[model samples]
Target: MAWRRDNSAFDFHFFRFFNSASPNNTMSSGLGKNAAGVLNMTIQEVYSSSENWILYFQSGVYFIRNYDYGGDLQIGVDSKTATQPRLLKRNGTLGQQWTLTKAEDGKSWLLTNGLLGKDLFLGLDGAKPVMTADKTKGTVWGIEMNESAGLPAAGNDLITSVQNLESPPVSSSSSSSSPTASQSATPANSQTAPPTTTNTGLLTSPTSSSANGITSSVEQPSQSLSAGGFEFDWGCCGVGFAGSGAGGKD
Candidate 1:
């Protein structure tokens, strides 16, 4: 039972702030519908500050996101790594290109852009709220009441200004490809007895490996933007993970 930091009160406060800025039907101008699909929040909602969805999984409604963008999306994580939790936008991509999958717990729903087949869940452990995956339990996330209901149906054009705080699917961890040259070769002495195989080994491999027989030894170099510049390399596994500027510019 991991212990949650008790942000429930804080989340409630955040919700009130966001709720105040919205209306029954925000699509005042009215645009094309979900030809692209329906997503969780609108780009407009994201930037409005007042309309941002609650992005945590406590007892209230929460937001979940997935970086299943054909492996794109990047964020300035730190000097060495471009955070692993950023979602890049598709060209001509609309922010509201997703739909919500109502869960058995009607209040909770899975937000998907209508492709890549995935859902959202609350990462809680033992009664304590934690930020990790629990494939069996469901992201178990909820939003501020019926905010999701307020969203337009399948054909409605989605609004921008929104972003979900969802995690990639449990399947994502299973299907994702881990880079060949990732971690520094763990010292033979550093190795721990393998845990149950049925479990993810979080240490298992994601993608393919190099000719060097699965690049068992790799080092995360000091992270810093190259003299060239600092930007996200969406099409690739991000510069930080691919090795300094792996997908970056020269």
Candidate 2:
């Protein structure tokens, strides 16, 4: 499925696929935005190059903002009992901010909320995805960027250009859950639901990316902070090595 910014509707087909109440059993707050907000997605082939998404933080934290509402992936207020994630307005609120950290293995990244220190996990065995303290195999994410998808590194200086934007605000939360236990971040659909892990299985090589001038050079020191009682590095998650455009084999 090719996802182009010029698409007629939302950000490709998955936007509607997940928004609907079908195979994707996850709960949605509400479909707020009908059109896909400006989406700049790219697919890479090799495993290491896929980790090159760190620059997204350099520019500013991203909301995991799905097309559902132009909304963000937020931690529900009742974290203790109902830790289920939701979609909310992109007002730069604390709960919506997320950091993509490089897990122990160079393959997967951990998605942690800025406000709530909980890790995002997809429910396996027909369970709905939720944010919780469970560090089971479900929490690790095997992300990949490739050619099949239409989104690519169309312009140069894509990463640097994003650096100009203001970062999201930091917020405190009552949820002090610690990081979940480590698990192999493989592209396994058995842990996280297939719907959410479709791209995970697509791990490949750096066929292309919007990050042209964004070299694999060292980045500015990142700010360290404590959120929801857990200490973590802000904007300093894992960084990926530069790769060739020809793409490598699986």
Candidate No. with top lDDT: 2
Over the stretch 1-250, how does candidate 1's per-residue lDDT look in tens digits?
Answer: 1112212111111221111122221111112212121222223332222222222221112222221211112111122211111233322122213333344543333333312233322222332222233445324333332122121111111111122323333454486421111111111111122111121121122232222112222222232222111222323212121111111000
Model 2, position 89: C-alpha lDDT score: 34
lDDT of 2 at 13: 16
lDDT of 1: 0.23
**lDDT of each residue in 156-180, candidate 2, tens digit only:** 1211222122233443863532222
Candidate 2 Cα lDDT to native:
0.30
Candidate 1 regions exceeding 4 Å error are: 1-51, 54-85, 90-96, 113-115, 119-134, 145-250
Worst 10 residues of 2 by lDDT: 8-17
Q: TM-score: which candidate is best?
A: 2
Angstrom error of the Cα, residue 242, model 2: value is: 13
Tell me the TM-score of model 2.
Answer: 0.37
